[model samples]
Target chain A: MAKKFLQRLGLKDKLLAIIVPLLVLAAWQGAVSQKLCSELILTPPLTLLNTLLELAQSGDLTLNILASLKRVMIGFLLGGTSGFVIGILMALSPFLNRIFGPLIKALQQVPEFAWMPLIIMFLGIDEFAKYFFVAIGAFYPMVLNTYQGVSGVPEKYHELARVFDYKSFRYLFKVIIPSALPSIITGIRLSLGLSWMFVVGAELFGSDSGVGYLMTWGRAVFQIDLVMAGLILVGVIGFAMNFLLERAEKQFLLWREPVDGRPA
Target chain B: MSNNKGTLEIRNLSKSFIVDNSPLQILNNINLTVTSGSFVSIVGSSGCGKTTLLRIILGLENHYDGEALMDGKQIVGPGTNRGIVFQDHRLLPWLTVGENVAFGLDKLNRKEKKLLVDEHLQLVGLIGFESVYPSQLSGGMAQRVAIARALANKPEMLLLDEPLGALDALTRMYMQKELERLWQLEKITMIMVTHDIEEAIYLSDKVVIMSSRPGIIKQIIDVSSSRPRDRASSEFMQIKAEILEEFHLGTEYTFAYAI
Candidate 1:
């Protein structure tokens, strides 16, 4: 009986969510038919859909998708790993925090795209430059999140672990890391989003291939359809990445739920 | 480490907390001994340093003067031999019930660790909840899991800092009975710090009544009742009255209040 009520509540929420998006899409299609705005300013939804279909049929789309994905994966791994290590070190020792904290914070203040010119100058407008930008974009969030996660662990849990004779690595991995994971996940989500933005900006600067480069190519040739396609693809891919991260979070962080069967 | 069996002897134990510019004295000239496998409950008013005393005993606080000797060896820090359950369950939110129980068993092999966790979960009547997380548990249930986790270490002494203070009255009663059963079956020492006077009288072999402010042992009363104490017994009420008077709470406050 209770399960039925909860399922009904869930269905209601799902229905409510679908309603707005569907209405927006319909309004978009109407605006295109009526020529509500200049075609240059606002491409029709059907035209955008048709362009997406054309890209899909051409097979160039796959290469572009793969290029963006590879860059994100590499940059994400490098940035996330380094950030995690440095964050944990900073959390464990005040001396390390004092030495590196100011420098990292200063660097973080500059947006990831702001470093693109310097990176392009140093790395010479190659793939490495793009990867480096994505990495920097991904790095700050990971480190800051990790530091907060580790340092924010309750003193009570530390006391409990000590009483249990958990010292050294045993105490760190078993207690400290697990206690700090929710914050770590939040950081990861933020960095992942930033990486998408950085990869697009990198492609815009001077890449021969990738989604961002394709969008720039379309813009140079006055192929607004292709640009629209690239924009849609980026939005979809970013959304998918975020969705996957949310699912993983639900699976991994079950213990954080409240007593009333709601997510904490 | 010296060996003297399971005697817990505290010699001239004094603890103070630094507040603002001055030191605030908590436990002053505290001296107490708890025999092995004995159930000792310390009852006191609010801010009486009951929790502080427990923290010192558990080796979580080290700024105190004097010594806490477990079996003649001075306690320098927390040890596996002394396990604690705080008023809150304090179960790690990222771990499942079985994993939380196995948190202290980092040294044990996987198979042995699983067995120990399972055994303690069963001991607490939480056998089928092995896969469930702490967030899915009730207040009483979560506290039981905390108890199970502490017991999985097989500690020589279990320090409970008001383990049942957060539970409802009915659940607290149920947990009290369950605790008494576990204490008798496991036969490990228990030192509980609680504000519940009736709970102290009902569960403890000896009740140590403590005074407020600069916390000090006001009286130590030995309950001569047989095991599985009847709450309705006159002897139980009399001891409860005595302990209440020691803290100036009066016998009228002994009537069971919802936890």
Candidate 2:
């Protein structure tokens, strides 16, 4: 009965989802008022909100966000496209899979940050280094997921394709790709999250204007409120990106009926 | 509708598979001839290799010895000349009913493909369900779509591997009538593999029975009764009894029917 009620939630019940967070915030504010910790160490939510507003007024927040967004887009496109292509190639050809499969697995094992020092030395502390780092982060998940998606297509579908005597390109696009789309979309979603995470890591070392840089600057100047504001902004932007991608996924996968027999 | 277009001749057909190391024979010394536009049903219990025989004729399995000839040519592999519907509807989940039918008409231009898809959809009496995806369809409806898909290619022979097996009893009976209508209208040769004895008797021009343990054809009974055969008719019961007797299931089946 509780599950049924939850499933049939109205607007009033939907609003209840926010109650826990609001209560947590109230407790946090109360603790700050009672001087539970030093002000510099723990900034209240109100002070962080004020800092956010001030940054917004100064236009530095928008500039930094745009700079970070630009880097993310460039890196995601470069990494996603190449990963998608290579993944498909690997899935289609046993020879290519054998040649590069081990190498990809090895690269996946090494931490993304471990390559940072060498990448900085090779490409210097410029946009290229940051972009390269983010690309590497995004690339691995995309490759792994796409490879799995393509390689694991049901043999029945392949038999259907054979029955139709579908041409190679037609089979790949119409049968293979559409069939593997759910997995590929999952990979893309993971890649996007990884890209966002790598942006902070990429900006942490030798970066002047990004959300990560903003946080670093706040830390350097002992401004806890500014750091909290930066953290909030990153969280909000990541949530927004994820929300948009989820909407896209829903649109693309409209034909897929839910396994539990819920409405598509 | 030219009835002379789809003649099938199978001669000295045999198939076996290597299970572990020893060759376990699945089909043995099978021979059958199906005239153009005839409805032939191969009925046997499970493990009788009826489906395997259908697959061999459909050119899905090639390791078998002997000949499967469509018209005058030897069957090589799955081609447009022969269309098939499996026990499962097997419609791609991503495709709508219309799109699934159109999947067979890959060679046609878009306009022609649309026309053919519509025609076949209407042929299967699914005119308004063009946009509905496969997942939303009931078992009987999905099988109808499968039939539409098979007919979209305008193959000389339509192969059915228990196409209506998944449907409920009521739907199965309804679909059997629909299958009869389709056969009459299309005038294409149909080779169906089924285990249901009554189903074999109801629609088939000829019913071929096979025995298991190195599956081999035991007998082929001719159903020369008129169209719209009555299930309770003596003629139908006689043929059903004969087929059951071959499987040593005659007394038991009759007792079950009496109950």
Candidate 3:
């Protein structure tokens, strides 16, 4: 009886999630009508919606979205690939840890924004610079997470592998990689989110394309609607990407019981 | 080498680990001998280093003194000749039961390996669940898969460290019977470490009881009862009582003895 009650409670909880967003939108519209803030500081919902439609009709919006997506794809590919390789290497070798571990740790301490001015100087604000920044942003977390995952394989598992005479690359691919997969996938998801965030930051620094650049253009021309539209689009896309990755993570790691099912 | 496959003799075995800036003695001067196709059980309290001794024998713990001789040859590292079943079924979570069982038999052709895995799964009474992964298995079922995996190697000796320790009472009882049958069928030299006195007595031809903290063999009881020992019989109860007395259980001195 209690199980059924809890299940119904969970269903009601999900309904509240749906209701809460609608409530927030209603509150925003109410605040706009009440004129709680100057239009410059907080653009009303209808104005932002109208701006989004106008931009879509102009075709520049899609182009900007495409450009940003392209940068994210390229950067994520490069960064994620290298991070995975290096992470595995570091996990496998204590010697590599001694040499590169400290260096990577130091690099991680600097914010993505801190790299902006230096990267802009080196690559001259080109597409390469944007892609490079996005890639670098993705790399550290991916590498670090993979290293932790691979190295964190319980000693017992390794011993089992050894007892089975699994001391080769085949063993690594079959046992170690599968064992480390949850962590690796977590790293990839994190890297994916940062790829988008860093690409936006790259665009913020005077790129000629992307939603970020378009937002910049809007702000310069005093088109508050366009800026709001751009922010909303960035948010939706970021949320969508994260949502998709989360689903992928669930599918990939189906072996692990969903967190809710298992006891803490 | 070809004829004398299952003989194992350990000489002056010792192991220690550094703990809090001091060398903690785990195993001290352990030695044993097992002829071909014999069953031995090592029973001790938790943290008595029984598992450590098993690890040393399996070559999983190499930072130990003394040599393990198989047919008078020095055992250096884990070899196919010694199969080990861990307490937790270390079956790869991602691999299906068949694949996990087939894991160590990578040298065999795909067909042969499949056949062998299927055979062993049947031997362990997990025949139809070959396609299932570890996550789908109950604790006892997973442990059975671990046993099947170990048996797939067709090793001369099987080293099981509390292989059924995770199972509930009923399952453990059933598994003990199954293990004994499997042992009779395979004729592999079996060495198991368990704390359950009944289990040790029920399954083993000989039981080596060890003392706690800086572990050492306290007593070696020879279970002289013949095949299919009667657990409910007076003989079995008498043996159980004797073993319990040796461990100082049901005695006024139990606490002091344990210390």
TM per prediction: 0.90, 0.94, 0.88
lDDT of 2 by residue, B134-206 (tens): 8888889999999999999999999999988988999999999999999999999999999888898899999
Candidate 1 structure quality by residue, lDDT tens digits, B64-147: 898899878888788888888999898887788899899888888999999999899999999999889888888888899999
The per-prediction i-RMS, to one decimal, reads 2.9, 3.2, 3.1
Better of 1 and 2 by DockQ: 1
- Using lDDT as the yardstick, the better of models 1 and 2 is 2
Q: Which ten residues in a row have the lowest lDDT in candidate 3 chain B?
A: B250-259
The TM-score of candidate 2's chain A against the true chain A comes to 0.91
Clash count in backbone of candidate 2: 0
Residue B230 of model 3, lDDT score:
74
lDDT of 3: 0.86
Arrange candidates, best DockQ first: 1, 2, 3
User: For candidate 1, lDDT tens digit of each residue in A135-240?
Assistant: 8888999999999999999997887777777778988888889899999999999899989978988899888888998899999998887898899899989999
Instruction: Give the worst 10-residue stretch by lDDT in candidate 3 chain A.
Output: A255-264
Candidate 2's docking class is: acceptable
Please give, as one word, the docking class of candidate 1: medium
Each model's TM-score for chain A is: 0.89, 0.91, 0.89
Greater DockQ among 1 and 3 belongs to 1
